[model samples]
Target: MKAAVLYARNDIRVEEKAVPALEPHEILVKVKATGICGSDLPRVLGDAAHHYPIVLGHEFAGVVERIGFGVSKVKVGDRVAGVPLKPCFKCQDCLSGNYAQCKYYSFIGSRVDGSWAEYVAIPEINAIRFDDSIRFEEAAFVEPSAVALHALQHIRFEGGENVAVLGGGNIGLLALQWAKLLGAREVTVFDIDDDRLASASRLGADHTINAKHPDVEEQVKRMTDGKGFPVVLETAGSDVTMRQSFELAASKAKICFIGTPAGDITFSHKQFELMNRKEFTLTGSWMSYSAPFPGREWELTLHFLKQGKLNFKELIFRTFPLDEINEAFDLYRTPGAVKGKLMLLPG
Candidate 1:
């Protein structure tokens, strides 16, 4: 099998490697498609990887080639999407059905070899079978879709109120769609890029704002009649958008920060004071998971994809063959190089 092995910072090579063997509860998947995630950027370029000579990719889908002795949930030839989190089932958090909170969790792609190769072995429990009608590329998006859904679930969203999503990246776009699906009276997306904002509009966002504009807040105020959004989700890890979130929230609103911050953040007296004045319920969301292992986040993502309610195809910006993994990583180097998801065809 061939895998993209990262030997050092900014150094990734597609090389021959032995195929992974399955454990009793594991299954061998012939990886068909995988996606490059935002979290993968620093690990590949900033020396953030856990170790050297690692295979780094987690968002993926493939066909089952073989199942181990105890595998029963899925069978050979079943098309499935991979769940990357491997929580220690015995941990107190895991026992309490808070798998994402488990301190003893090992993530695929980041903590171990991931689906960046022709063949990868994963626990059967980590595989979510999808309808055959769904394309491998769409199935590959299940992980990110789940992440977007999980973020909104943190706010206990009941919809019918105005919602604001800060950022128009893949996750942000998905968040906007999920907000609409969950019954938001209106969903607005904010971003610095016009192309991304256009993508948001195509993905069913009721409104899109270019956050780069000096009067962006005024525009938002007009859109919401000055009350602001009752639900605010910040999916751009940028300090600018993170700071803007406080001002975007309505009084006593529910706000969730889903994007991971890349650097230290400091707020001014007036900026931080908004939270105190508004009395909003601010929360931070982690990786997608809940009570029953992989949880409803993963389940609902697949369901919506199968029903054609989710727009997975339009979110893909480009696709590269596994042999061109290095080139794919290079695309991220150029400012504003990618507008949406970048996919990899391992087969």
Candidate 2:
């Protein structure tokens, strides 16, 4: 089997390696498609560190080629998507139904070898079965979409509030659709990329504002009649947008921070005062999770994709074979590439 192995920062190569052996609790999946995520950027770029010689890809889906001794939830040849990880049922967090808070878990893409090769092993507890009707390409997205869903659910939303989403990247775009489906009165998206903002508009944002524009804050104020959006989601992972979230949210608004900021973020006294004065309620969301492995976040995302409700297929951007993984990363790192989710076909 051939795998794209990251030897070091900026040194990823496609090389032959023995196929992974299956564990009694695991299943072998013939990799069909996998998607690159925003986090993949820092790891590949050397800004954020990752273990050397890793096969980095977690947002993936495939067909079951072989199942280990104890696997039963999925049989041979079943189409499925593997959750990036599974929690230890014995952990205090897992036992308490807070799977996301599990102190220790094996993350397929980062913690272990992932689906950037011909086949990857996944624990049965982390596998979600998809039907033949869903395209492998679409199924590959279940992971990230589940992350978006988990963020929203973590906020304890019951719907009918207006939402302001900062960042129109894949996660932000997915957040817009999820907000609408959850019955948000209106969904507004903010981003520096007009193209992404356009995609957000197509996806059903009532308004799309380029965060770089000088008038963006004023425009948002006018749109909200100075009251500000009741729900604010910061997904850009930038200090600027993180602070803007405080300025754009209404008094007592629920703010969800889903993006992993590139570095330390500081708030000036005046800027921090906005949150204090407005009583903004902020929650930081990590990787999506729930009890029973991926929980409802993973399940609901699959349901939405299967029903054709959460559509982003047109943004598949580009596809490449395992051999072209290097080029794929180059394109992904390129600015203004009209790229959405870069897919790899390991075949």
Candidate 3:
């Protein structure tokens, strides 16, 4: 098996390794397609996770090459995508189907070896079979798309309210579409990148704003008739944007933080008191998971893609074979050099 192994920060190498063996109730999947996630950037180029010499990939689609003795949900030659989190099924959170909240959760590509190579072994229960109607790349995307959908589950949408997504990246764009699909009256995406802002518009943002604009807050208020957005998503993951998220949210509104903060954030007492004064419902969304393991997020992502209600190919900016992973990383890390997702095809 060939893999892009991350030996340490700024030290990923493409090398050969033995194929992993499948455990009982597991399936050996011949990876057909995979995509690099935004989270992967920090893990590869900066301090993100606690491990060395890890195979770093999880957003993937594959074909089953072999099934363990007890596996029944899928068979050899079946096309599938996998839920990357391996939970301790005995935990209270796991028992309740909120697997992301499980105390002993180990994520593929982070806490465990992942599908950066020709093969990856996944528990049969984590595999979701998809038919030929969806492309391998699209199937690989279900994981991230599921993240977008799962974030919304933290709040209720009774319609007639606007949605504010504070980033125009892939996840932010997906969140924008979902806000519309889930019944937002208007969707506005904010970003500093012109290209990503344009992509957001093409994908159905009712309005796009450059977050760097001096009048960003004023424009947002005007767009929402001075009430601010009732439903807000902070997907930019920066200290600056995290603070602005509070500013953009309306009184008594629901705000979901989908982006992981890169550093410690300092807030003034006045800023902190707003949560109490406005009675804001602030929810922190982690990696997507729910009851039934992969849950409705994965099912709905595939369903929407199959129905042509969604399309992200425009967001798949580039595809590299396993041999060109180094180049892919170089390109992805270049400042303001990209507008879409980068994919790695397992050979």
Candidate 4:
């Protein structure tokens, strides 16, 4: 087996490695398509300070080539997309259905070897069985789409509410689509790049704003009847956008921060005063929980894709073979690419 191993910053090599051995209750997936997320870039640059010599890819989907003992949820030849989080279910947070908060929570790609290879061994518990109708490229998106859904669920918006999503990257675009699916009357997406803003419009944003332009906040306020959006989601992970998020949200509105900012942020005292006066609810949402809930949002996202309600095919801007993983990373890190999601295909 061959895997793209990251040994240090800007040094990812495709090296031959022994195929991962499957553990009992685990399944071996023949990697088909894997998406490079924004987080992968920082880790690759050594900015995120992750362990070296790691296989980096969590947003992935593939065919089940083999199954471990007692793996009954899926069998050989089944198509699957999985939640990467593996948690100890006995922890207090896990027992309370907060799997993301579990002290022992860890994910593939970041902490462990991920899907940047010909094969990966995943616990059967994280795998979600899908039919052959779903393409591996589309199924590979289920992980990030699940993250978007989890953010939306954390906010708990009412029907017919307006939303402003800052950033037009993959997560922001997915958040726009999920907001519509959840019955948001209007979604306004903000991005500095015109191309990304255009992509966001195609994904289902009612309005698009270029944050680099003057009076952006005023423009957003006017679009929302001068009351500001009830829900403002920051997905850019920039300090500028994070600061502006508070200014664009209405009184008593809910703000969900989905992007991971790389460094500390500074805000005005007046912004906190407004939040207090408006009784605003500020929250941060991380990755999806592993524990089963009554309405699995990931399953719902799959259903939406299956029904043609959510179209993400256009979001895929480029695909590269696993051997060209470094080139793919270069393109991802470059500015003005406007590429939504880059897929690494492994055969």
How many residue pairs clash (N, CA or C atoms closer than 3 angstroms) in each of the candidate models, in the order given? 0, 0, 0, 0
Better of 1 and 4 by lDDT: 1
How much is the lDDT of residue 159 in candidate 3? 63
Superposed model 1: Cα runs more than 4 Å off: none
After superposition on all C-alphas, the RMSD of every candidate to the true structure, in Å, is 0.8, 1.2, 1.2, 1.5
- List lDDT for all candidates, in order: 0.92, 0.87, 0.87, 0.86
The deviation in Å at residue 80 for candidate 4 is 0.6
Candidate 1 at residue 326, lDDT? 83
Instruction: Tell me the deviation in Å of residue 286 in model 2.
Output: 1.0
Q: Can you write out model 2's per-residue Cα lDDT over 1-347, one digit (the tens) per residue?
A: 98988888878899998898998878999999988778887888774545787988998999999999988788999998988875666788889988777778678988799988999998987789989889999999888888888889999887999999999888899889999999999999998888888889889999998888889768987899999999999988999989989989899999999999989999999999998899989999988788666688889988888888989696687889999988987775667874587889998
Predicted structure with the largest TM-score when compared to the true one = 1
> Model 3, range 1-347, lDDT digits (tens) per residue?
88889998888888889888888999999998998988898999897856887998989999999999899889999999978999999988888888988889888878888988899888998889999999999899999898988899867556678889998888999898888888889998989999998899889989999988898878877787887778889987878777777888889999899998878998788877878887888988988888887788999998888999887786899999988988988886688887789998995
Looking at model 1, report the run of 10 residues with the lowest lDDT sum: 212-221
* Off by more than 4 A, model 2: 47-49
For model 2 the local lDDT of residue 188 reads 94
Error of 4 at 148 (Å): 0.7
Question: For residue 79, what is the lDDT in candidate 1?
Answer: 93
> Residue 137, candidate 1: how far off, in angstroms?
0.2
